[model samples]
Target: MVWSALGILLSFALVTAVHCIFSIQMPSSLETVNGSCILIPCGFTIPQSLKESLKLPVSGIWRNGSRWFTGSTDIYNSSRKLNEIQGELLGDLLQKNCTSVLYNMGSKYSGTYYFRIETGFKYTFETPVQINVVDILPQPILSHARVSVKESTEVELTCTAPVPCPQQPPNLTWTPELGSITETLQTDETGSYTLSSVLRFVSSRSHHGESIKCLLQTQQHHSVSDHPCAITVLYAPKTQIEVNVSDPLYEGSNVTIFCSADANPEVTQIRWFREWRGNVSEINRTDLTFTMTKDRVGFYYCEAENIYGKQNSSKVSLNITEHSSEDGYDTLREGNSSTVKWLLGCCGAVLMLIILLTITLCFKRSRTRSMQGSNVNKSQIYVNFDKNFSNLQRESRDSECGVYSNVSNSQSKPASEAIYENSSI
Candidate 1:
C-alpha cells in the first residue's frame, strides 16, 4: 500500500513538471492605426492534469492592467455576454488556439493585457501583450525596376500597404492608370500581413518624364499616398525642317532654313544636304538656321542624331530664277513672276529635249536604210560574178572536147535554155 501511494505521488510530481514547461505562444507587442481594428494571433498549452480534468464550455478571458483579478478591468470574456471592449475570439480553446480580434481601437485601448483560461482549474498566463495605437496611418511603400529604360521594354512597379487587420485590408491603386494591375496578400517574417499591387506595361517614348504614384485607402475611409516616381525613356530623334522666306526665290533673294528635332536626350549633331542635278552634296553650315544663295538652289533636307539613333527630315525644294533686264521681267519679278519664269524654263527645257530626241531617231533610221541598200547591191554583184565564171568554164570544156554548141553565149540564155544547149555530150 505504501509503494502504491509513493507511485501516485511520483506521477503527480511528473504532471506538475510538464505543466511548468508549457505556457503560451504569442507576439509580445503589436501596433495599429487609431479608429481601426487589430487582430492578435495567440495559442497556449495546458498541463496534463488540467487536460484530464477539463470541463465542457471552456472560458477565455482578457484583463487590462498590472494585476490579473485584483485591480485589472475585464476587457473581453468568452463566458459573459457583455464586456468592456467589442471583440471576438476566433480560435477554439479546446484545440489550444487562442487567436482573438478587437474592433474600433483607439488610444484608450493601448496598454498591456493578459490572457486567462478557466478549464476546471483556473490558470493565468504571466506573459503580457503590449498594444500601440497611433492617430495617423503610415504611408504605403512603392518600388519599381530601373527608372530609365529603352522604348518597348517591359516594366513592373509594385505598391505595398500594411494589413494590421487581415479582415479589413487596405485598397491599393496606381496613378494615371499605367497598365494591367494585379493584387495579392502576403505575410512577412514577423507574421504581419501586407497587401501589394503590381503594375505591368510596355514602355514608350510618350511615357517619358511622367510622375507615377500609389494611393491607399484604409478600412476607416482614411486616404493616403506615396511619393511620386518619375520615369525617363530613351528613344531616337524625330527631325523636322522649316523654311523662312519673305519674298520669292529670285537670283539674289535671301532664304533661311531651320531644323528642329524631338528626342529623349537633346540632339547631339545636325547635318544639312542639298540634292541638285541628280547629285547630293553636304552643306558646310551646322547650326539650326542658315542662309542660302542662288547657287544653293536644290532639294534641301536635314539629319538629326542622338546617342540612340538618327533621323532625316523630308526634303524641301528651293528654286531660284535668273533676273532679266527687260521691262516686262522687272514688272512681274515679285511673287508670281519668279514662279512663272521657273515654269516657262522647265517647259522650254522639256521641249528642247523632245526635239533633240526626235532628230537623233531620224538620223539613226536613215543610216540603217543606207546600210541595207549597200548590202543588197553588193549581193547582186557577187551573183553576177558567179554567173560569168560558170559560163567561161562551160565554154573551155566544150572547146577541149571538140563539141560545138548551138548557143554562143550561155550567160545571155535563160536558165532552162542554158541547161539544154550547154551540154558537153
Candidate 2:
C-alpha cells in the first residue's frame, strides 16, 4: 500500500507540473502607442529536467495571427530569418527563467501571441500572451481661416493633433477643394507636429463655402492622418444708395435730407457728409435723415463698411428755394402793373375824342354864318324901293330872326356839350 501511494503522488505531481508549464503569466496585456516601443513581459515555469534542454523559439515568428517570439520583430533579426521578417528583440532569453522582451511595437503587433515549450517526455505546452497597440495621435481638428477677407487676399489654415511617435515625426500636406494651395508647412518639436498651410489666390462669392484639408503622414509605414479646414474669403462690402429731399421746400426753409444704402454682411458703419464740406457728420444708422441748411446744397454721399472692406455711394445734391410773404403778393403785383397800363391808354383815347369834336363844331359854325350873310344881301335890294314899307317889314323880320336864333343856339349848345363830356370822361 505504501508503494501504491508513492506512484499516485508522483502522477499527481507530474500533472501539476504540466499545468504550471502551460500557464505562463505576462505583465498584464502590453499596451503601447503606434510607432513607439513596448516591452512584452513573458515568464514561464517548467519542470527542472526539461528546462535544461529546451530551446527558446526564434524572435519574431508568427503564431495564430500574432507575431509570437521572444521579442519585437521590427528591430530584431536572427541569421536564420529573412531580412523582411526581422524585428527588434531584447537580450538573450534566460534559460532557467523563460522570459523575453519585445521593442519597436506598432499597431500590427496587436494580437494574442503564443509560444510552445517541447519537453523530453513527448509533452508540448502552449502559452498565450496578449498585446494592445493604440494610436496616440489625436483626431484631426480644423477651423475657418477667417470670417471675411478681400478678394485676392491670402488665406491661412491650421490643423492639429496630439503628437504621437516622437522618434518618427509626421509630414504635413494641404489639399484645396476650390483654390490652389500656395504653401504647406509643419512645426515640430519634442515629437509634436502642428501643420499650417497658406493659400494665396483670388477669392469670389463662389468660394464662400469651399473646403481645404491638411494631411499628416508618418514616415514609418506611411501611415496617413488628416484634418480639414474651411476657407472663408473676405470681400469689400457692396452698397447701393438712394437719396431724397423734402418737397415744397423754400430757399431759406429748413428741409430734411435722407440717404440710404443696401449692403451684404451687414454694414458695420455708415458715414454721412456733404461734398461742399469735407465731412458733416458720421451716422451710426444706415439710413440718415437730418435737417439740412443751404450750405448742404452740395452733393451728398454715404460710406458703408464692415470688417472686410468699405464702399461709397454716388453723391446727391440738396436744393432749396426762397419763400414769399403772402400767397396773393405775387398775383397783386402783376395785377397793378396791368391796371396802370389800361388807365394811361384810356386817357389818351379821351384826349383824341375831345380834339375831334372841337374841329367839327368850328366847321358847322362857319357854314351857318355864310348862309345868313347871303340872305341879308338879297333882302336889302328889295327894301330900297319902298323905304317906309321896307323899314316896317325889316323890323318884323328881325324880331322873328332873333327869336329863332336864340332857340336854335340854346338846343345846339346843350347837345354838343353833352356829347363832348361823355367822350372825354
Candidate 2 lDDT over 310-386, as tens digits, reads 88877666776666666578789889999999999999999999999999999999999999999898898777657
> Model 2, which residues run further than 4 Å from truth?
1-111, 114-170, 176-210, 216-227, 231-265, 268-271, 277-300, 305-425
- Any idea what lDDT model 2 has? 0.55
Task: Record all residue pairs in model 1 with backbone atoms less than 3 Å apart, i.e. clashing.
Answer: none
- TM-score, cand. 1: 0.66
Worst 10 residues of 2 by lDDT: 184-193
60-86, model 1: which lDDT tens digit per residue? 888788645788887899888888778
Task: Point to the candidate with the largest lDDT.
Answer: 1
Can you give the TM-score per candidate against the true fold? 0.66, 0.30
Q: Residue 375, candidate 1: how far off, in angstroms? A: 99
- Lowest lDDT block of 10, candidate 1: 402-411
The C-alpha stretches of model 1 lying farther than 4 A from their native spots are 1-19, 53-55, 144-146, 219-227, 288-294, 320-425
